[model samples]
Target: MALAAFGQLNMEEPPPILGSRSVDCFEKLEQIGEGTYGQVYMAKDKKTGEIVALKKIRMDNEREGFPITAIREIKILKKLHHQNVIHLKEIVTSPGRDTDDQGKPDNNQYKGGIYMVFDYMDHDLTGLSARPNLRFPVPQIKCYMKQLLTGLHYCHANQVLHRDIKGSNLLIDNEGNLKLGDFGLARGFSHDHDVNLTNRVITLWYRPPELLLGATKYGPAIDMWSVGCIFAELLNGGKPILPGKTDPEQLTKIYELCGSPDENNWPGVSKMPWYNQLKSPRPLKRRVREICRLFDRHALDLLDKMLALDPSKRISAKDALDAEYFWTDPLPCDPKSLPKYESSHEFQTKKRRQEMRQNEEAAKKQKLQHPQQQQHGVGQTHAASHWPAGPNHPMHNAPPPQLSHAGGPSGHHYYQNPHGGTPGPNRYHPNGNQSGGYNNQSRGGYSSSGSYPSRGRGAPYGVGPPNYSQGGGQYGRGQNPIAGGARNQQYGWQ
Candidate 1:
């Protein structure tokens, strides 16, 4: 009884590690990423020779020693322990050039490079999805989804909100085990009646309706919406569900797919400032299943509940784990049994991102050089949207004519239409006598413009049917004449 009393009286906080144990402890490798708050590096621990990711918390001009956000994240991550959650091993400070010969850290003259060491991950979800060759089978996708939900369940149970949930924040090792990462936007909640949260936490595409409508008080439902969006993205060729240009357009896109919100559907939606202001009462259209025909009924049902317009009605993570989608055919594979992908995801992502940066730089230079001439036309960049409907389309049910192309460009390689003549004064024969994308003077399709795409696939870039020609048979001045013209040229494949 006396020892217990003495221990209770003498309890104290652990000593603060004001400096690193040694300057040469970690071998600094190449920088992996740079963000608004800090930079991450791939480093090696000299003592253990273990590879790790070191995130440098930037404390450039703050009179305060360490960043408050960093401190908060560290505190929260230390309490979390799960197979699907990133592990924070330790925190250490790197001594700057101002240190003495003995490598003692000097706070006054030293640049504080406080680092948070984390478990090494081979790739992020975004990088893995971006790989041209790697494909996520149905079982693999289910496995990933299960892991994500499991991690999110743990966080919500601990009263922590992972406000920023996106593909890039999920890390995966070589063994196909996925782990939740990027705690910079995470926040802890106290067990009290009042809890205030910022609405501008998630990425624009993954944001839910409540948050988009300026909701400041929210719960785990906010994350469930992101899970739905991520699931949809995984099924739909790794593209965002709602890619809108502006906030209003984004809301409109949501309404178009999920049906517009009424007070009965989404309680308190009419009170939102953005409700009646976006499109002045457009009709609600529901076509989510039609758009995502790849998913089965059970998967669709789970996604519907997860993406409910009413936040109160959204399914919780624990509930989602019990959905019938998981117990269906093509059962979720074990993480260790999943296919092993190359660790080249990081390099490929960096290369693609660098190329995109270069393209943006080039576009900026072009705009600066000729703002008057080429004023950012979306039609030129995205030609697929403007292509004619397919042969089976209701409005375009006419059987197409047999078409062929040669391997050379000439001054007069005109089409041999049913009119049985070279393109001339009478190019328009309205009665089903049309040839594919015409006005050809070619060794290839376009000499001064567009490249001649190779054959093998059926209709390279949705090459229009033979009946796409309008009343005026002569190709117009601004016409896109090539059958399989340029589309998403920046990305390597179709």
Candidate 2:
């Protein structure tokens, strides 16, 4: 009895890992996509045979231990619970390979890889929409948009900002369920509007005017702007409403389509630090309805509210869900009724397109090198002019443009209309200032100070001042804390 009591008194408990598993438990089938911070693999659990996506955390360039973005994503996802949001099942680690001279395990526990496991999604919005000859019906578009807004509403209510909202970041399952993914750029903001976040976020095409104008003190309104872009893209038959290559170009496109922001419209627009530097000549008039003439009245109304020039005036996700467009005829179809599609992802589809381009270049070179042999063939029809059916034909050498990255520069290059002409009416003039207003040819980068983009794909907006506060706040989940408004002073917003 004495021994039992002593054992109970002195027995040590195991470290509380919370049932953390190892990556060995899951079998990686193939790589499906890549995010800003890691490579995503389509994996399956060995025991349960449940398919999942394993996002391998990138560590090569991290001289300072694990990435903070990954940590924030894991923490924010833990607090969020919604069907529209991507479910982060659990974190799994690889077995360490480091060993001592005696072949025993070493002290280093961080040598192995780390992976975040999630439910495997069949296709991202970009890939699914890119499939040629696949036009989403009105009902289907409504269903997807509703799901997106519902998920976004949940995120906003939780105070989490998904700064990067684009087609590629939205994952869709075969059952027509859409979920918000890629929380690497996400941050938890305060309700008091006391935090200042980097304005250089979201892809160039979907970015809002407020962000482009260098407004560091922002809120959920920024995300609504992106939703507005997606809404237009869906209604426009999968064409991006505003596709811009550079920062000035992006803002110009926004001005042309949504109309230039002025004191009359956006009030306090001239107060933004970069406003004087970046503001372009006011357009003749707002063209939201004129540009989207084919769209029904309800869609135009909702889009105008969402893409409001004033961030304060922008529509909230909750209000967007209650818009008239969803209540009208041809209501959203049941998600179960949506057709199942084969697995497709942006990474795989983009790679295939790259290979096709290379093949085309090779064919062009062969034709140039052997001009005589090509013209001398008696029965050789005009293969270049027509798409031949036979496998041997050069026209049939590659896939049929299955992957369409539509956000490619619209007013310019290769993104011509199906009718073989530049985009009608929407095409922007390089020098759009006919009225003789602020016109500056020397444009800058994504930062408020106007610098060049240096982080490449890793930091699409380019690195800026640290986002979090030094002294941990209420929302600090260990390393990542809620951003403070102290940085706003630098940009003159405070």
Candidate 3:
């Protein structure tokens, strides 16, 4: 079902799908992608050794039988026989072991192990388009678009509305054939004009103005608009034409580019539920020629028709396939002739490699910024243990401040001498006093009141250890600390 609303429309239930293959029949490998209804795994069939994607259906709250989404998908996929659409090979399950009085097998565990096997695709349109190294050429783009439109045409002919049409849902096998996959959000378009459908279906970026304005009776025009977006993205090297961040922003961007719609363009647009919320300002419209100048006239024309703001004006998938753009030069190439790639998981590989590179660069910068910090941090740890009483130890966060030695101003950085131990308060007074070690505050060795308490003897009031109360400054004893600087005298700098 549609992730944002009720999916399938009222219709006769399709035939029940039955399968004999058990879960053990396929060897589970790595997970590839996930969906709203199930987790898809890349598995190998034990009997045929054929690689396939197995979608495990979530059977929670299934008192009403299987999920509507799975059921609809199984029914629709089984009937669709187009090569442009992903083929649902079969259904498989695990009945578990017997747990009954008569030794009969209870299939309760089978609920969690049901799988929908599908043909293995080598890549998806989203993944391939995201490959930084792969730029889709004109012919390649045309080829993919042809296949996409052809599939959509088949779906439309069968009255199946693929509401969720995005690049990731388009799978590509090794032969380069593109197939429409993921029908969970698909539903039959009722011919009854009175029946109303949910407006919310396609992804925000791909959603049309009609849906954005809250119209609930939209038709195939909604999907055509998404196709237009995909077409532009493929041509412009993967950059979406309108990559808005929110619903309001998406509407604004769309209106800004397509020109504001009114009764003349989209009849009764203002009457839509959300119209007043995001009133169109009727801003200047952005033409395809200006936005996608690289596209030739015919291609641009087709793009314009597909992106027509009015649903009635938009081209049908069948008609689009017959557009002049396909008949023009650099014609659509054969899908089989397209370049072959490694595993369909190339997108994931490229993403992880990019993340690894970023992490490595960040690590290098950190090392350069703090080369020897680790070793210094270790030494500080050892020092912290030895001094236990040491004030605010360093954990390599940053270098410590400076302090002058009480023995005298023999040189700067007396505190840097690791063997000499910390200077000032730590060395002068065990009580962490001369507290203002560097700023020279109270209890500090430097005198105040513009005068020193000179002992007028061998060692000037030196009262600590190593040279405490004993040895004088480097100048020895009985000498004036300074020969005399009037400036030093005035500022009491000494």
Candidate 4:
């Protein structure tokens, strides 16, 4: 069945050349892997003749034409050039191509697509862990753990959060230096910012208590939890410590090993949105011994601190790297001197292609099952005719347009209250008016007072006008649109 699927994949086009104006610098060798939104290929540079990996993304799969996560990764990678993180070389995009009835490229065909170029990595941590004859000694394990922490520290130091930290995302070079890969789940943090409001990030297995409980406001501590799990996995030959089939089961496993959390351990535990419903107040039970018996007592101690039930008490990545276990005699092996594995690339390629075929088949089944729905899934159509380009269009390089309203600055206008205090029933505008352009007005506009009506009274003070509507404010007449010195305040706006 897999062979038949592969045979149907229209391989006639000689695996689209990497440098056909759609991409430069690299020459396509073979398909290596397929991600949720893109295809990855092994390629070599045309100019430097250096081997590299090229990732091609289908614009149609992204609502904004480019995935925001992908954009975020690129932005973070561009600024973070470190030895531990994967290096991003360049980005290329090509216009859509016109093809003849026979599917051959027509002379007038406009070729356009998006491609990302990255440094070539021989294998990932998952492959290494699965090798039958390979046994990771304690010293070698320590080296990998230290390297992982070093890379993690680099990310955290730069105020970046790697929400997804797992073996598959850890890339290995020929020298065995494990560099952190996959910034798709990373987010930048601003100093003084307390919590992140996005709870739906990170894989379930590696997710921390804060995330599993639906706490949007979290911190780097979330990533630290995953690091701890990765550390345990490295020590135990790549086995997850708290592997669970469901969210509740996963939390149960975590509670069993670390014991239940409390205010004493996690000061802000009770304040979390899901705090009341969790089993937090229950008596502590479960022993760490049942998890991994081979872990040395000192290593177990470090793991205990790292996998603390209370995020506030969990050891930071920096602290974990400094643990005495790492410095003990028979110290960690140098990454450069590690032994190399035989060709696993072909196996990886075949496995990835099979997964891609399965995914495509599943997508086709979904389409057939939901024929009544819109023919194009949320982001399926890629034809240029359906994608209109404008200044505000996500694909365009122009800034969003400015909007104006009566009684406010012509540059950008919004409705406000006349009482010079909170907005009244008649002073609200349902649609938002901004300097760039008008958003759904019914959604409500920012107040000159610099508070969002939709946000609770105790909500953190924001910089610009309120983004959404909440309490006290109503939809109606636009007044007091400009607040005194509201624009000059630079609090949450930045």
Candidate 5:
């Protein structure tokens, strides 16, 4: 009965017009992931046989016309052109079902839907990092970081801010290229910091302290703080450096890692609207160098600047590119030099982790039931039977299945280094210093992007997006421009 009901419901639904010029150009393969605003599917272009990702725009509850977030994303993508940035190929739409008196389509009726087309990527950074036993070497980490900073630099130069920067937002192809995606939370900003903006943006874990303290007017420094979180995650073996469950908890984590902010270190912190409401009860000593002692001296130095308590003191993406970490030994390798891996997505990995946990729980229950089952031998066999392939399993010993990233089986080899050896610590360091960065607690830190324009003593703030409903914000609206000296150091990159 349930099956018949389901079939009837499906039959009553209107069939999607699949062969028209709009949505008919491509065939959806499968659902790859979901985002804040809509679902994403793997698709293939019929004309060119090229694989792509189709991001469907959600308009189910919108009484208004097209979504403002989608409009802003489209506008910003059309203006941005960079290798590390995700490219927006074109948008396709389906026709609505409404008709008028003469049987003609209703002019006022909204379109059936829209899909944002993009190049298909095999994995996101989070998924790739979650693969069992997979560890990223120092050079590979540098390669990814450099690409991330480069893309962010481009966005800042163009006066755009990617408020949400997280592991899943960073897409990675089999060839090792990393492209920044998910620009829904992004907005444009003017150089004058007089306008009020929302601080309720950016993922909690990667959000900066300024935003937590309720700063309405901000700049590119917020994005740079996210970059710092990502950098620390990579260095800490793919685990998020600050995984806070709530806004209050997230702020606490920041205060714990970094020292409590004060007027001395952060000139205007005490004046922030939420400073008193969210400020730490007691001052916390700066423990960055203490906790991250294993990290490279140069990398820690850059991280310190990136995660500075004061937004004005934070490093810009352009200046980050020139940091000593990139210039040190075990230099960043070419993206193409990285190894090829199976297709992985955060959605898939989370499911797998859940399954593993369930299996373990089942095994524990079985052991509890058969407590006397030879005191060990039979229980071991039972648990092994329920386990997924382990290191000793035949499935685990077999060669990893290759993916057709470029075209065919041969294309899987394209990600392999053309040189004699793989680009990793083993190829460069004989002692295997890949995991030795925090071997001791003795290290010193000091340091500090297409960045904002150089500001003098009386200049304005970084450019921000214009005020629109949901997408745009007004600039220089009956407000004073921020002091120039504080922000001048941020845009020092000439």
Candidate 6:
């Protein structure tokens, strides 16, 4: 990936170039903040006469081409249209002057580009948490937690996993509506695909225990673990629940607070890659009261379920929405009803624009001063063979249909009997058993051509598509089932 090249060699290419002229419908306002990969600016939509946020990514430092994370973030945002998630209006790729002499084209111009257009928002939850006088009321904190969970639930249901779930990634609009942004660490899962080979994703601070132990075949449970940490942070007034300088230290802190995992609590805990090397000497036996004396009992109870060491036992997004903590008092306000401000309290909207222009100029100067690093010819060869497929790959399609609208009092009610008490035809018919036109295309050892009939019942969870069907052939026993069509018989079981 281009990112890999940037890290491996010292390159002197000017940082990615920002477009001189804003897009047709938007007028560049001001620079708000700078990030590892790019700078953010406030822009006004000329057509709608509304303000929006535009992030410009620098590609000059990149060795191969565009960063994979950026592409992944864009893909996830384009398909996800939710109230609690940030909206991506458009992506602009424009040419500008090149800073590095060696990388300059015959015309002495840079080939790098920028991305423009996004919904404008105020500060992130991280900044809000740092304010000393802004003691958020219980009702208000609950409101934020509920919105965060709701957004997470939406992402999980869509089969999109957000590896990073921190305060900085959560943005609050002027109306105080919290939306999930920064999909740089997000990944999409599909039933038909095998697990990827990489285990390097997510920020170290919010990583789940399973990930810390090096388990690669994880699911939405990984994300749930981070959400649990964020919940604890909220209750503690922005203090991290498990703050460690390194992976081992973080695990030790978690064990100290929640108690060590035993066979009964987590069946496969001992077999993880790093399990033996960093085993905790003390087992966790403290009650919730000892951890945080000041936390509300009800909120603490929810946090316990979310932070469960056993991924299987962790509370799901659907179940979390039904928790009593959310229903007790100070109900969440509608996203559209939150307060909106014309300008940020820290920086006047106009001044921010001027700074952004200045930053761009400074970036160009820095690029010109640095000596250009030689590019390996190998990058061009690798780029063609490993060109990233856009968002439409079969393996990257929408998540399996969720059991939406089951006849239950709450969304969590379906967990009581996840299978709905009816087993369907044996689509995987054992060895040599030709039950459902078994002799078709081969996947692993099973026929991929056979059609599994889908049985449509009332929505099982009131979130995803209705009814579970046996679609993707079994990758292994006890493996998570993938979604199939409505006509396939795999629908009846679970």
Best of the candidates, TM-score? 2
lDDT per residue for candidate 3 within 242-276, as digits (tens), equals 66546787778887778887777778777889888
Off by over 4 Å in 1: 1-19, 61-65, 97-110, 190-193, 276-280, 344-348, 353-494
lDDT per residue, candidate 6, 4-106, as tens digits?
2311211223233434554544666565544456556666667666776766665656778777767666667666766678777677654554222123332
Local error of candidate 6 at residue 329 (angstroms)? 2.5
Per-residue lDDT tens digits for candidate 1, residues 1-494, read: 12312101111223246445553587766555555455566667788777777776666646866666676677777766666788777887766642322345434444646777787776677666655533466667778997798778778777777876777677887666778887777877543527767776665666787777777778888889989988886765465576554566667778888888887677788887656666337668666766665566777888888878888899988777667776565566666565445443333354444455555556566546655555446666654443323221222112222221210010010000011111111111233212211111221121221122222211111111221112221111234222222211211111
- In candidate 4, what are the lDDT values of residues 1-494, reduced to their tens digit? 22212102211222223334446445676665554555567666677666767766545545555567666777776666566787777776645652222345534222466777777777667555544434466656777887787677767766788776766577776555667777776777754667555876655556788877768766778888888777776665444566554556667777877777677767777777776677645667646655554567667778777777677778887677556666554466655456665433323623633455555556566556666554566676553333323222121111112211111111100000000011111111222111211112222322222111222212111112222221120111132122333321311111
Worst 10 residues of 4 by lDDT: 411-420
lDDT, residue 103, model 5:
44
Better of 2 and 4 by TM-score: 2
Candidate 2 has what TM-score? 0.72
What's the alpha carbon RMSD for model 6?
Answer: 24.0
- lDDT per model, in order? 0.58, 0.63, 0.60, 0.55, 0.65, 0.55
Q: How do the candidates rank by TM-score, highest first? A: 2, 5, 3, 1, 4, 6
What TM-score should be assigned to candidate 4? 0.63
Question: What is the TM-score of candidate 6?
Answer: 0.61
Model 1: weakest 10-residue lDDT segment is 408-417
lDDT of 2: 0.63
- lDDT of model 5 at position 341: 70
Listed in order, each prediction's TM-score against the native is 0.66, 0.72, 0.67, 0.63, 0.69, 0.61
Model 2 misplaced regions, further than 4 Å: 1-19, 96-111, 368-372, 375-494
